[model samples]
Target: MTITEPVPTGPATTLPGALSLRAEKQPDETAYVYLRDGEEPDGSLTYRQLEADARSRAAALAAAGLGGGSAVLLYPSGLEFVRALLGCMYARVAGAPVQVPRRATGLARLRRIAEDAGTTTVLTTAEVKHDLEERFGDHPDLAGLTLVDTGALPRAEWTGGFPEPEDIALLQYTSGSTGDPKGVMVTHANFLANVAETEELWPVGPDGVVVSWLPLFHDMGMLFGVLMPLSSGMPAYLMAPDAFVRSPGRWLAAIDRFRGTHAAAPSFAYELCVKAQEEGKVAPGLDLSSWRVAANGAEPVRWRAIRSFAETFAAAGFRPEASCPGYGLAENTLKATGSRLGEEPPVLWVDSVALRADRVELSAPGEGAQPLVGSGVPVLDSVVRIVEPASRTVLAEREVGEIWVSGPCVAAGYHGRPQESEETFRATIAGQEEAGRFLRTGDLGFVHDGELFVTGRLKDVIIRQGRNFYPQDIELSAETSAPGLHPNAAAAFSVDDGERERLVVVVEADGRALRTTPLDELEARIRTAVHEGQRLDVDEVVVVRRGFLPRTTSGKVQRRACRARYLNGELKAAAAAERSAR
Candidate 1:
């Protein structure tokens, strides 16, 4: 149950060193392949070519006097992002991979990140730079910044040495689902340690091929799509996020074509693939037997999604045991715990009534039971403790509390926020003062039967009449309540109505469904389902067109943002129904 042994450290300590070693060992071997539109091969790089390109980028950065400072990496998902990231590693410049700004809000976020990192340089492709300049050339926050197109850099040789293990390698910005984004300073050692831990859990042989359509800005994408394969000396197949979004089947087709052994995405993506297959959108006769690890993370792991996907893809030689559920955060790099390879992920059914009281109890298969999927056990030298948030007391097994982790993978702290970092990253457990600082995860989970079972985020829990409720549970009920509701597009939150807290549910519905089904009937179905399922009366139900509800970049419903929009009358509700419930 206790997997605390350290993973073997490789001869290379830093990312640049790892790539250099791989280049020397396998110069002609393909290191990465870019799949344009998730199907056609557009470009590729051998180990030798990749290293040379990275070194040239490093040389350009050094010549620009940008060494030892941070630069925002604003490239789209492709080979350019990978080269720029590795180039920063070689130059000892902290690379902050940020999503390409498409709107005012995204641009504001980019400006905040740039200000926080104390940098005025932006590294991106020439096309993107030209477009940004044409669109937002006179924007106040962007006017003073210098955008350097990496593709246009003059050829030069890198003479700088590799960065030290403790040097900052990346500034992984947290997904601002609930609040402002903060940059987590990930050191070179942190990346190496996380890769080592992942390799120990899911060993990738020389034949391993990683296929990913996840955005490089996200931690899950950077680790699995770039770092893991690079460190394991395996080739990775990359694709843009839009390709998978437009056609979920492309992801599976890529796996089939490339014989990909490892791939990962959020749970909704799995659900989408299932829907696509059911709709006859996926290509027929896919041989997915080669996929060894179908990692599901970056969001809550849904047992329904796992079971549905395994059952749907069973005809394609997809093994049920290949589904790996994991738990992690930006603060801990990528993964803290992962399901063992070649084993079925564990699921536990707990009494719903007891769960509301923060107690775990076995329950039969009925309306009163709620399923909790196991996210596996800790890997490497990582130590996980379930500590009561307010009391700072360590809880026994099966007792739900905030998850605190300490390991080499944990980042140093948030960039330029000393006070907040001290509170979050330097917390001491009660009566275990000398056990080293633990990173407060703000997640609620417990170690039951030697496996971690995450409950919900501490801040997202809704309290109604002194009873605890998780927004995900409420959102799930709303999703299945009616056929018109969009999958994974419900936001449940409580709002104060001059007295106590009242439940409010906001959901997105397809245009066809909206036209066919009566609005009153749809609202009634959602309210009745929640009332019967959770024994909680909904005070208001607002239904909007599809894509109205706000979502984070990783596709998680931003409940707080939805609540704000609802309060400010920004959400144009297609139909709304309210009840005076007390």
Candidate 2:
């Protein structure tokens, strides 16, 4: 079935309106339950309280002379951030929710975003803002921003209400894991349509207990953890993402503790869940029968990860049918496709050799087969087409091509980037004049038997632990790690070493460093700088001699060539790194 715009939900077209209706209809009903560090609830709020808090925050923004514009939201994951988002909806402002950066490079990115969005006002918690200012006061990137604590406002002063359906509600910045981050304009209509369609796949009601530990800044986290509950009239239980990282069992234990019915997470989380079970860290009394929809999306869903999770947790009342693998990007408003509830997640085993030739060949039970989990069909309100990238010709089922999508849930365009918006959001078909709008997702996938199987990205993006890391960014970080490196002679890439994505950085070690510094020490320095700047680990740092990396005629580093060389065991390092070729 082709996707369609949402059928009207009785004045609940916009998020704020839906929330207001819920509060009026069930004022005393619990809307959200938040946990900070333990199993016990840190705080809870009812629909009435949520509405009041949102309105009060909006009123505060209005009093501060901020309206009809966008405001950057800077807060950690918690109820305060949720209210800030809701308050933006009521204030008729688009909230560009950003995480509080902890590093200088991250600060620069936040600065770039603020400058791009042209915002001077920032919404944050009083405590968080005060602490941030104290820590980041000297940094010019944050010095000019006027921080407003929306949570501190009184409910009586709330004046802003529901916004227009077509008004811009949020600017979900693309995850920059593949490239530079750009804001995707998500209108109220887009928000409503996506929420309605997502709920159809993972059906839920007021009694549906939703548990989440995703960071609110990520689109996947924001869409599922913060907005989905309000739109579907479900109660959500939230814990900070860091808490889950420290203890994956906390996330699973939360479901068992709360009898959670629906939950969404990235592939890493499912892997972590499996790791927890293997380590015997999972709660013994955990019962997952109530968790019917354990949806995994945001990153490339691995069949092995889902299969391990389902197999390990089957004894705990978890059903294989509950493992839902899906696909989505920020440009499509979070979820473009997902498995239907009660259906075992779709998977395919393709011959590794044929796949390289852009052909799909089903593999035998035991061979050099690549396992790919199907992201399921396009949402009811969305149209997904596998298209030949160069020709724009729609491909037949099982023919691998770029994934293109169109629907009401599709974003308007990239914010302030008209050319990119037109190219990515309003793509043209090869010959179908009647096709009005389609988004060219830079993802390679195929449709077989009405199921979409994403293979890999068309861009040189390294997706690790569900976060996209651009190769250029990593290369720059590595190049500038020390002055000994040759200019534009570093490459960064990711290769899956069976278990997970391994990041490899190849650099040209300068003659001075080769003579003066220990090679391993230099590699360690590069690792520390990259980790400090990008907030992630590098699997290997290859310090090669001059002219080691492949370069094009324009002196541009051929990252693919470098990746090929490394993968083929042809890359040589000048440093004495006992690195084994993966």
lDDT of 1 by residue, 38-156 (tens): 99999999989988889999999999999999999999988988899999998989988888888767788788888889898999999889988988988886877889999889988
Task: Write the residue-wise lDDT of candidate 2 on 1-582 in tens digits.
Answer: 111233235768788888877887778988888897736798888988887778777776777667788888888878888888888888887888777776665566677777778798878888878887888888888879888777766654564446788899998875443125688999889988888888888889656988998888878788888788887788889988778877989988899988899888866568668867777888796789899888888346767678888898898899999988789888998889988888998778877556655689998645456677888887676999999999999999889889999999899899999999999999978889588789999988899899988876677757765555556546656876875764366889987789888999998875676777677788898898788656779999888876666643223466776787888776753333423311
Listed in order, each prediction's TM-score against the native is: 0.96, 0.80
Q: lDDT score of model 2?
A: 0.79
How big is the positional error of residue 156 in model 2, measured in Å on the Cα after superposition? 4.4
Clash list (residue pairs), candidate 1: none
Model 2 misses residue 412 by how many Å? 0.8
Using lDDT as the measure, the top candidate is 1
Model 1 misplaced regions, further than 4 Å: 1-10, 177-179, 572-582
